[model samples]
Target: MGKTLAEKVWDEHVVRSTEGEPDLLFIDLHLIHEGTSPQAFDGLRLAGRKVRRPDLTLATEDHNVPTLDWDKPIADPVSKTQVDTLRKNAAEFGVRLHPLGDIEQGIVHVVGPQLGLTQPGMTIVCGDSHTSTHGAFGSIAFGIGTSEVEHVLATQTLPQAKPKTMAVTVNGSLPEGVTAKDLVLTLIAHTGTGGGQGYIVEYRGQAIRELSMEGRMTVCNMSIEWGAKAGMIAPDETTFAYIEGKPEAPKGADWDAAVEHWRTLVTDDDATFDKEIVLDASTMTPFVTWGTNPGQGVALGANVPSPEDFSDPSDKLACENALDYMGLEAGQPMRSVKVDTVFVGSCTNGRIEDLRLAAEIIKGHKVAEGTRLLVVPGSVRVRLQAMEEGLDQVFIEAGAEWRGAGCSMCLGMNPDTLQPQERSASTSNRNFEGRQGKGGRTHLVSVPVAAATAVRGTLSSPADLVPAGV
Candidate 1:
């Protein structure tokens, strides 16, 4: 049988197999962040063990750092301690760390790929749930809990059972204004957030092949939302081009040899997946979440679904609860919803490309008078690049609060948060109840939609804010 990309990468990284047990796979990269690594490091200390391969691990402070001030001390005691603990742990374990104010500091997922540490065919593990973001490079990456984090730190290997494989083939060309965020949200809606259970999904077909590396990352980053163990795309020219000049990428002859190996990473013509799904990208549009879960989404032009529309009893109950939590009226046009805040930053959509897209729409406009708008970069590197292109100026001139890099507003770990009873149009992933703050309601949208919402103080699309031409 022809092997899928996930199988090929898994086979190459397997160190040993035990009778009647899962293989002990070797991990090439271990990523750590402030939210989950403190306890893992404590476990290692109590056991009197040191990191087996510090060279293979990297650490950064995100999730708990204030985005508004890079130099001031963290105001939240719990958040401050988390960041302090990570720094102490990294120093004691001889692992390199990008502190809060460092130029390389940002979301762990964003920093890994930008630094060239996430390579094709490598096994990557992180303490963050969104670690699957690295799969864009054809790597087998997944999230690990704190216990698993300590296991990898002590042994440099993980005992994991192989997962079933599924193929999600998106064919045809994506329409204008449709983005990776829309594509992923649509997939979750189709798959019901539990369709990929017990499987690693491989994204294929012409539409996926045409996506840039960053876009691919955006797709794979949300695999977990669909119950997939991981999601990956085969490495190709787009992947190679993105990694060419990265700090950790191969050089000279090594680069040439690596490309040759990556060329053979694709699934064979006859390869079989445990399951397959096909989607037409041209039919997709800007998607937004109307309910608490990512799967509860509709196209921008559609109305919020009434509970009666759900045929299944369970689904009907879920819809009722979601509507109550979100304070949304059934059958109402989603575009007419008002928002108190607008956030555009997270591991999922805080890249330079995402910032550029949002900036393009907000260039000559100002944010709504009563709305709070925050524009955060994904990493220090992204922040610097955006400044070089004057994107920072454009955002600042639009009356948006230009902030430092971190996982701000993606979750409530940091100081950036929505007040109680506040509704927000956010570009970040996940819209679960209380995700932003207690009693805060979130609606997920694309970068352009987020920008437009900032301008109008409502859930609006870019088409409504900007004309077709400039």
Candidate 2:
């Protein structure tokens, strides 16, 4: 039988395979950050082993790094220690380190692709769940536990059972106001949170092909949120164009050779996936999570659904709890929901392209008086690029806060967090309870939706921002 993309990538990286034993696959790139590497480094210290391939390993300060005045000492000792420990370990172990002040410093997932370290036909692992973001380049990328991190540090190989392959084909074209984020949210809602379990999902068909590299990354970035082992997108001309001139990308003949290999990485024509799902993109609308979980979402035109609307006992219970926590009522129009914070940044949507879209959509529009709009770039490089384009000024003039690069407001790790009972229309992945902070409610949204929500101070579709009859 012809092979799927996941199988092809897995088979190419096998170092050892035994009957009754998990295959040992060599990892091409191992990305690490402050929060998750300390213990892994400690494991290395106790074993007195150096990083087997420091050249292939990259580390940076994120999670706890402040988006504002990052150069200043971190106020939280635990956060400071994690950053300090990572720096000490990276320097001691001779690994390439990008600290807060470094131009290359930023979220690991964002930095990898931006710097060209993430590429097609590679096996990548990070100590972060969103590492699947790198899979946008057609690589087999996934997250590892701390011990797994240590194992990769020492051996650069991981033992893994093969996951089944699944295909999510979105036919036709997405509606004007819909985004890659909306498409992925619709997928999760179709399959629920555990829908992709034990599978490596390949996003294909017309709508996916129409997406730019940035849009592809946004879809793959949230794969983990749907319980997928990882996500994969077949490398194509668009992928090559995005990586061709990056700092770590190959030059001249090397580049040509790399592209040749990547071209062969797609799933075979006769390949059959273990599971399949098909959707009509034209029917998908911008999604907003009325409940805490991402799967508990509905269309922009949808109303808040009652728990009793669900058939499954677990889903019904979850819906009830989510509604109570989010302070929402059934039968209420989603557009009527108000928000105090509108965050535009995360590994999912903090890229340069995302920033540009949000800035363009929100230009000349004042943020609502009671709303706080925070626009943060994914990396220092993205931050500098935005400033050069004066996107920062556009946001500032519109009453939004132009912040530095980091995973701000995506979770409670950094200083940019929502307070008790505070609700936000966020571009970040995950809307779990306290994902932003204790007693905080989150509604996952696309960049354009978050941009419009900031101006309206309510959950809104991007279409609502347009002047009528335009």
- What lDDT does the true structure give each of the candidates? 0.92, 0.92
TM-scores, all candidates, are: 0.98, 0.99
Candidate 2 whole-model C-alpha lDDT, 0 to 1:
0.92
Error of 2 at 208 (Å): 0.7
* Candidate closest to the true structure, highest lDDT: 2
Q: Candidate 1 has what TM-score?
A: 0.98
Off by over 4 Å in 1: 466-470
Q: Taking the tens digit of each residue's C-alpha lDDT, what string does model 2 give over 180-297?
A: 9999999998888899999999999999988999999999999998899999899988999999899999999999899889999999999999999999999888888898888989
Positional deviation of residue 410's Cα in model 1 after best superposition, in angstroms: 0.4
- What lDDT is reached at residue 55 by model 2? 90
lDDT of 1 at 190: 91
Per-residue lDDT tens digits of candidate 1, residues 11-121? Answer: 998899888999999999999998888889999999999999999999999899998777999989999999999999999999999998898999999999999999898
